[model samples]
Every structure is written in structure tokens, then in C-alpha cells.
Target: MLFFLLLTIIICVLVMFYIKWVKVRSYWAERGVPFDPPNPFLGSLTFLMRKNPSLWMRDIYERHRSRYVGVWLFWRPALVVNTPELARNILVRDSGNFRNKFMTASTSDPIGSLNLLLTKDPAWTGIRKRVSLAFTSSKLKSVQAVAAAKSLDLVTRIHEEGVAEISLRTMFSDYTTDVFSAASLELDSNTTLTGEGAVRDITKEIMEFSLPRGLAWCAIFFWPDMAELFRVNFLPKKSTDFLRRILRAKFKAKSVELNKDPKTVLEILMQMMRKSQDQEKAYSEDCIMAQAAALLVGGYETTSSALTYITYLLAHSPRQQEKLYQELLVAEEKHGHHNMEGVIADCQYIDCVIKEALRMFPPMAWLDRVALHDYKVDDSLTIEAGTPVYVNGVGMQVDPEFYPDPYTFDPERFTAESIPYTYMPFGDGPRICIGKRYAMITLKNAIAAIILNFEVLPCPNSPKPAEAEIQKKGLFLMPGEDLKVKFISRK
Candidate 1:
């Protein structure tokens, strides 16, 4: 009698679980939306077999070609916004309902949770508004000075390695690290010339997501419950400690300074903190460190990787390179050769090349947002509140319908009228990259300095367009293989 009772209880529990799982799987199907059947456990993510999620989503986007397609992220149902119309509706028209990003780190992870990139608004709103003031035209120009000095160092480094095959990614990383340290933190990291510093070490560790770190990030971004349950921290403790130490040191050093011109981003942040405190308000040091970490993370890998891609594209397309070279030469002649800023500003073709490269490979594969309320997407579809919405940037940007012969690298395509809602390399709407101007200035300066000093050429090891390797997981689309380029001194 006792054995029979235990068996009956076990059977009832199994039946209840099965019924709940079925209802969860039927979420999108009942809404009249097309969906891929999810795995019993992994859901839509089962398709990912050591593949980059961006490329996987791009495949799904191409197959469905629907305005919106339903999929499951792990056990949770998600919507992939495919068409420009749907994207605009979610990202712009109903932005208020989708203001917060879908991902959040565990609350236990203070360094990872409090960043501007992940922090939800009302807090995000005030922080963004204050930070935006630091990236103003004059402030960016001042930051450009650091980039200019680093570019000179970059040219010197390349000159020393004349016509030798080298990893462009590493070279660019060093340069950007130096510039970020000097411009944002107001420190002479000197990684560009000497190739070693605390800033360089921290940036490397932050971006280098090893297997465990990658899994932690995956849970933090895609499976919030799992992350919270496990208390997963995306930023390693050592890296967090390093950032905090450096920030505290800089803050302490700055406190004693008599002059306060607010030249660098750190200075601006300090001034903001002081003003906030004077008004009888409290701004925690952790919050201040979070913002500084955002700057460091934002400025480190993305710009360097972007510069590497731009160079690779230029090397592959010699005709385009020649055209760009001619444009740069003309700009230098019109303004004196000493005017690096003028040269970077006037090279329209160079700008076009950068835009095209970005279209081909956006830093992040998709733009993510969460529906804060029930957003009526169209007559047929109303995304439920709390659903995850992902705009397939790689899919939309590469679609032949949106761009003619999208695989071909043609800068002329940009000369025509801008493609609405399709070409968001920095993202779109209120949440677009706040440091876009900073990125552009830094990229242009590095590219200009390199092109002026070296003829970027393909090497035996340079990965062809079809052979480009995508990292399995990270904040941005990082290359898995070494980016080799032969630098022939043009001087």
C-alpha cells in the first residue's frame, strides 16, 4: 500500500510538468506567428553548435523572411524583428515600451550590473544625459588630440615593421588602448609604443572571454534566471578589482589638482560627481567606477577590431584603396600635410569605405530590446509585455532586397539616399551608441595615419571574405583567427 502511494504521487508530478512544458512551447503558435520548434530543453538555442549567435539568427531571418518570427531563447520565447517596418515600430515608434535592453547581469555582480550599457532607465536616462555632455563636439575634438598622438606612434610602429606580415588586430588594439587611456582616463598608458601597461592588461582580460567567462556571459545575457541562480559574474574579480583600483587612484590624484579644465572624460565625470555632491546628493563610488568601466570597455576592442576590418577590406579591394588614396592625397594637398584632422574630415570616400565595412560586419550581430508593455506591432501581431525583441542587424543589413549585391564591397552605394531603418551600425533611436562620434574620429584617425604612411596589402595568411571566423560568444563580433596584413611603407 505504501509503495503504491509513492508511485501514484510520482506519476502526478510528471504529468503536471509535462502539461506546463507544452503550454510554454505553444506560446508563439497560439499568437498566429511563425516559429521554429524548440528543443525540449535548449529551446531555439539548440541550433547553436559552437556557432556565433548572430550568424545563426541571420540564417533564421533569411529562411522566414517574415516581418517578425518567433523563436525561443533557451526555455523563454522570443521574437526576432526582421522587416524594417517592424524594426522601426519596436525601436522608434514604441520605444518607450521597449526602452530597457533584454539582458541584465545578476544583482550580486555589482561591477557587471551597474554599467550604463545594461542599467535600465530612469537611472540610465540621467546617466546617459550626463555622459552625453562629455562627448560634445569640443570635448571630442580634445579627445581626438590623444588619438592623433597615438596614430603617430602607430605609424612609427608600422614603419619599424616595414613590409613584414603582422597581426593587425594586435597592432590596432595597442593603439586604441593607448588612446583610450590617455583620452578617457587622462593617463599615459604608453601601450602603443612600449606595449605594456595596467590599462592594456585590464582591457585584454575584459575582452578575452575564455570558455568559463563566455558561458558566464551567455547566462548573464541570455538566461538571466540561470545567471541569478548561479550568481554568475561576467567581469572577472581580478578585472573588476583592477578597474576599481585604477579609478580610485585617478580620482584621488585628480582631487588634489588645482586646475579643472575638464579636458578628458575622467575630468568631466569628476566634475559631475562634485556638482552632484554639492547639491546634497550622494553618488556612490561604485556607480562612478561603472561609468569608467563602460568607457574602457566601449573604447577598447570595438574600435580596434573595426579598424582591422576596414584595412582588410581596403587591402582586398585595391581599386577602392587607390581611389581612397587619391582622395586622401587631394585632401592633404588642399590642406597642408600637417593637418591630420583636415585630411580625415575631407576624405568622403574613406568615410564611405568605413560605412560599407561596418555594414558587412556590425560590431554586435543583433540589437536587443525588451517589451516593457504590450506593444501592438501591427494588425496581425501584438508582442506581449516582457517578450524579448531582437532586431536582426546582420540579416537586414545583408539582405539583397535592402542592398543590391550586398556581398560586394562598394562605397558608392552609400552616396545614394540613406536606407532607412536598415543601416544602423551604431544602432538606432535613443539608445544608439553615445560614443559614435568618438568611434568615428578614432577610426578615421587611425585609418588615415596608416594609409598615409603604409600601403596595406594582403598577406598569405589573410582570411578571405568567405573564410572570416566569428567568435562563438562575446559582446561584439570578434574574429577568431589572427588578422594578418603586410604593411608596405608608402613613405
Candidate 2:
């Protein structure tokens, strides 16, 4: 009996190895897609966890230009689209055919994940109508209060933190979290400039795994089956429990508020739910948590990385820094004082600065989708239904075709005459980011306020770092080392 059992185990091992090896390789080669051969176990993402303090995704996307390159995420074949037109096709034009994104909540959060970024078809369209209306230029103009309050705290925090060597990453993170939480919840979260964490564990867990695009994000996408087999959580398990409790609590707490009057966004959502009968309606809890989670992840990371890069860029190029300061000063003088909307609207130079930074270091290194039905991009290649497709956004951002000199830091590339589909920092099409306006408000306001209040000085720790040395890690392009700056408050 023992001998037979041993023989059976050995046979099982051999078969498993055979199946895993053949499954990944044959899938892509059969499709005729250009692919890198996979490691039998680790697949194509062998260098996933290694700290590449070197290049960002621009290297990955450029290396595979002109074709959809195949990579393996542990036995799963993934395709990354390398060009701008093809990428625009993925994020826009044919977005409906490619609706469901990897790593988004699957039928679990229902209304919560039903926002345009995660959900699909009629459901995404419905909720997007309600939320997208809230982000229009007019609506964003109305929410200036949210930006002003958050900026006040940010400037004050810099004042209190006393201009020491601070990780602008952490500071900007707190500022954005405060703004997003207060706006989404409509409660005075009392987030102090020097204050510790304001909301609690729910948001903390939300951050850990929400938008991780490297190995962590891919882990949630391809290896969910393995996670299920091991009974392990890929996305933060901590967030799941906390989200349920906080959402339930908020729903319970809103009984009186809902009965009294409906003034806020949460109240508006509940009112919408009460009126709609046909579709999957977002409840108070669902609406609150969804917006909060979206803001918590997207709001902080996008704006923070943008701000971090801006500072790094400015610190290295003193001539550029002074030129911007003069521009801001002239704009402020014309406006009679500094206000975010006025400053952002009136100053074309500052717009250039922000746009240039976004061009070089986009927050999202890559974006993806899954085809719901078999589709053909051209006569030669036809991807079947459920095949994963992606655009390496970082590639498009750095492509010299769009921007004459992609590497040079000049903000004038976003002129009114600029062509469409060239830049996609907040994505595009029907599934573009709902909070794009809010992110702009956060980044622009923070930049304007920081420049107006303090002159960022180079750190004494080292000689001036090169423009390239200030580069980053993670799915979002960021500063690799702490881009330290001294805050000399202009009196």
C-alpha cells in the first residue's frame, strides 16, 4: 500500500509541473502574440519584488513598442498594449467592449464597486451619470470650499512641522486624506495639520492593497485562485471587515439625518436610491464607502506623487523654479491675491508646469481591461473573450511622438492646440476617473499654496541630485529617495 501511494504522489507532481508549464506557454504562442518565455514557477514577473531603484514602466512599455507584448503573472498570460492610438482604443473608443478591469471588486460590493472605474455595462453607466455630474467644471467650482479648507491645513502643517526635513509624501498624504474624507463624509473629521490619523483602520487597510499595480496588484488579479486555495487574502483582509462595520454604522447613524433633511452627497445618494426602482441602487453606506475608498486611494496617490515630482523637478532646476515663482507672483499680482480657482484659471505658465510634471511622471504606470467578447484589433490578431489587455500609460506619456522632446521638462506641451489621446493621467472614455476635477483641485491648490507660502530649498544632505536620480518606485512614478526640501517661509 505504501509503495503504491508513493508512486501515485510522484506521478501527481510530474503531471502538475507539466500542466503548469504547457498551459502558459501554449496559450500565447498559439495566439501568435509576441511573448517573453515564462519561468516555470514565477512566470514572467520574476523581477517583481526586487527593488529597481533604476527605471520606471517607461522602460517596460518602450521596450515592447509597436505590439502587444506577452508577460506571465504566475501561469497567467498578460498582454500590454504599447502605442498611443492602441492605448487610446483600450481606455476610450472601445472601452465598453473592454469594461471589466482586473483587481476591482467582483459582485461583492455591488453598489460600492459600481462606480465607473470598477463596474461594467449599464450599472457603471447609471452610477457614473450621478457621480460624473458632481465633477463637472461647474460642480468643481462649487466645491472650492473643500479645497480651501484642505489647503489651509496643508499650509498650516508646513508651518507647524517647522520646515524640517519632511517626507512631502507623508505630509501630502495627510492633507489629501483630510480633504477627501471631509468632502465625502460631510462630517468635520477635525484633521489637524500636525494631527495623527483621523478616520481609523478602514481607510488604512484600503490604502494597503487598493491600487497596488506591481506584484501586489497582479497577485490579486491572476493568482486569486491560489489565494482561495490557501484561504489567504490578496487584497487587504483588514479593509473588508472594517468597510463592512463602518458602512453599517454609517447607515444606522443616518436614520435621523435622512429624515431631517438631505443636503450632502451622502444624503443625495440615499435620495437617489429611494427614488430609483429599476437598477442596482447605491445605498447610503454603499455611496459613502465607495466615494471614500476611491478618494482614499486615487486622491492621495495621484496628487501626492504629482506634488512630489513637482518639488523634485523644481529643486533640481533652479532657473525653472525661479521662472515659475515669477510667473506665480505675476499671476497673484494680477488676481490681487492667491486663490486656487483663479490661480489655476488665469496662469497658463503654472498650467504648463503641472502638465509637464504629469507628462514625465504619471501617477498610474499602466492601465488594463478584460474583453467581454472576442475582439479583433486588426486582421492578423483576434483576442478571444475574457482575454486580458492593457496599455502601459507610462509609455504613452514618454513617447516623443506626442511631445516633441519627451524627456525635457517643459510645461508648454499642453497648449490649447495639443492633440487628443496623447495624455491619460486620469484615464479616458466612459471609464475616466470620476474625481479628476477633485484631484486637479487638490494638486493645483497644494502647489499654488506651497509655492506662495514657502520657497523649497535643496537639502544640505548631498550635492544637487540629477533630474534622473530623483525618479521613483511603485506603480505610480515617484521619488525614489525622500526628495527632501527646506521650507523657507516667505514673510
* Candidate 2, poorest ten consecutive residues by summed lDDT: 48-57
The number of the candidate with the highest TM-score is 1
**Candidate 2 local accuracy as lDDT?**
0.64
- lDDT by residue (184-269, candidate 1, tens digit) is 88886779877788889887787665778877878877888888888987578898899789877888887723255565678767
Pairs that collide in candidate 1 are none
> In candidate 2, what are the lDDT values of residues 351-398, reduced to their tens digit?
778778887777675776888888886677787787677677767777
Estimate the TM-score for candidate 2.
0.84
Worst 10 residues of 1 by lDDT: 255-264
Q: Which stretches of candidate 2 lie over 4 Å from their true place?
A: 51-56, 106-116, 190-192, 200-217, 224-264, 272-288, 416-419, 461-475
The candidate that wins on lDDT is 1
TM-score of 1: 0.95
